[model samples]
Target chain A: MKARQQKRREGRDSENALIFGDSVRKCKTLGVAKRAQEEMVGFMLVILLVAIIFLIFLGLASMRSKSNVRESAEVSQFLDALMELTTDCRITSFSGSVNPYKTVEELIRDYDRDLTCENGEKARDVLTRTIQEAIETSWVFSPESLYQGYTFEVDQTTGSGASSTQERIVELTWQGNAFSCTHAIGDTKSVFSASSTIKARLILCLSRSE
Target chain B: MAFVLVFTMIFFGIVAVIYTSVSLSNLREQVAELRERQALERARQLTGVPEFAFTPISCSSCIDFDKALALKQVRTYQDFWNIKFLRLEVVYPTPIDKDKECSLSVLPPNCGYVDIIPSPSGNIKTKTAFVDLVFWDKNKGAYVKVLGRVHISAFDVER
Candidate 1:
């Protein structure tokens, strides 16, 4: 009976050791899985941060491009308007005197009287109104913007062999503002005048019926 | 620990030397490029002029022509075009008396010449040996045909 009791005690001790070993292995596995999960979370957070930074930079670049486009368009429109006015001035009849206007305001008034849009009367009215508004909003009479008190004398007049005549001359001063600047100090002026002549004439065409 | 510290120091020293070398080389390249650009700009400034250099054949022909037309020629052209105007004075060279009566084409073209004439109306289509002012009428923007066969020519000479 003593020998049988000793065998039973030995068997119980061995089983307890096996169970302890299994418990240690399970703990090690759980620790390794926790470490792997932590590293994966770290990598995901880094990727997300980089993505957000890239998006912010792209948005800023897009906004900058848009602003540049707007500025360019404004400059182009202003230049176009000035050119149109110059062309029209080349066509108007300067009757009373070569020096029609002493100030920019006078020139603008004359320009307003002469220039009409190609569209119908309503469209022409809208354009004239817009130009008038631009004149009002901007300092069209600033000394730096224009050369004041310049002389315009008749250089030459030619009569066609026919009944009418044409006149041409160089004006020392031009009234339109050629340069537009975004900054107050950086504005420039266009001092050059058109090389082409302005002609006015009255013609009576003979009708076949007459 | 001591060996570990020494190794780390050596590694960082290598990285620092490499970075400094790269930065210095990049800065030198930028400086060289800027100097080259400045030299080119100065050269262009000196070569550009109004009289002989401003022509269609010049490498910078377009820019020179635009400036001449926009600044000098336009003003003069406008003055000539004004109605109620009568006289125009253009500078002409003194007549060169060559020994031989050369054909019109054989003589070196007038080095520079000017013609002064009474201004005529641009409306009538008559051929007269006179310079006339052309203007846009309220009805027609075209200059009436007064001066016949107008041509412009220019040449570029090396500075």
Candidate 2:
């Protein structure tokens, strides 16, 4: 009787061990599945962020291109208007009476002439005054913005082109042509005058103030 | 895993659609701008032409209206239609932005029947340029302000 009772006890113990082992295996599988789901969520989030950044970049590039196009058009129009502008600077000489205004493209053309006026004004002095006056009389004149500045330059490109484009610096007032700081030698970018078929080189620079 | 893959595909698809639409709309604006730019170049060259670039001993930056009126080189209404599209408005008395609209093409016989002009017959895009100027009317015996105002038009086609 004692031997039979011992055999029953061992059978019961073996059955309980098998049931626990099966449950342990199921738990391990569930843990692995949960981890994989978490990893997928992270990957999806990363991809979403990357796409958003790319879109923003595209938007910025488009905006930049539009702005560049607008600026170029403004420059073209300004140059055309400048060419169309004429000043009535009729300088009279004693030979008879010369109508110099006809061929004179701009009043600022007198800058190259070394002639002195009877009033003791030098050519350079006249240039300074004429330039100031031209800005006021210009049809396409715009009030200078705080963030933008402009420079007008003239070069003797009768043969080739302006030898150098970068020289001279001058400051201007925020509203218009008022020079914030005065320079004895004004910067010349290039504004050409046409006397007959002769073509002069003219350049204007627009820069961001900042 | 299947859900993740599906969600990713849908998100990327939405992004692509948005990007394409934005680019297409901007593309139209860019084309219109390009046409305007081309017109601007033509206007500049027009001023440099011998007929317009003449300067008498009494004139300065002045365009001769008489010479321009005598331009017989551009004949047919459809032939010189390019010139007809050119607008020259004068803004001397007024501000540049408020330039008066004027074009030699507005003369009788040259300024009618838009359908006959060059186009594939569809919705066309157009832009107007307000070019400022000073003009000398040799016939009218007075100084008139003339500005170049070009109405650049274009029709799109898939290349």
Please give the CA lDDT of all the candidate structures: 0.32, 0.44
Q: How well is each residue in B14-62 modelled by candidate 2, as lDDT tens digits?
A: 8789879988987986787576566555545545567555455333334
Which 10-residue window in model 2 chain A sums to the lowest lDDT?
Answer: A180-189
Considering the true interface contacts (CA pairs under 8 Å between chains A and B), give the fraction that model 1 also has: 0.00
Task: List, residue by residue over A1-210, the lDDT tens digit for candidate 2.
Answer: 889999999888899888988889989999989989897887768686967898698788878754221235534454444444433333444233233332223434444455454455554444444434444333233435322323444344333345434322222232333233221112222454453122322222233311
lDDT of 1 by residue, B23-141 (tens): 69868856664554343333233224453133332223112212322333333543442322211111111124423222222221111122212234463221111111122223533
Report the C-alpha displacement of residue A93, candidate 2, in angstroms: 7.1
Which predicted model would earn the best DockQ?
Answer: 2
Alpha-carbon runs more than 4 Å astray in model 2: A2-19, A22-26, A41-45, A48-69, A72-75, A92-99, A102-210, B39-63, B71-88, B93-159
State each model's C-alpha RMSD to the native. Answer: 21.3, 10.4
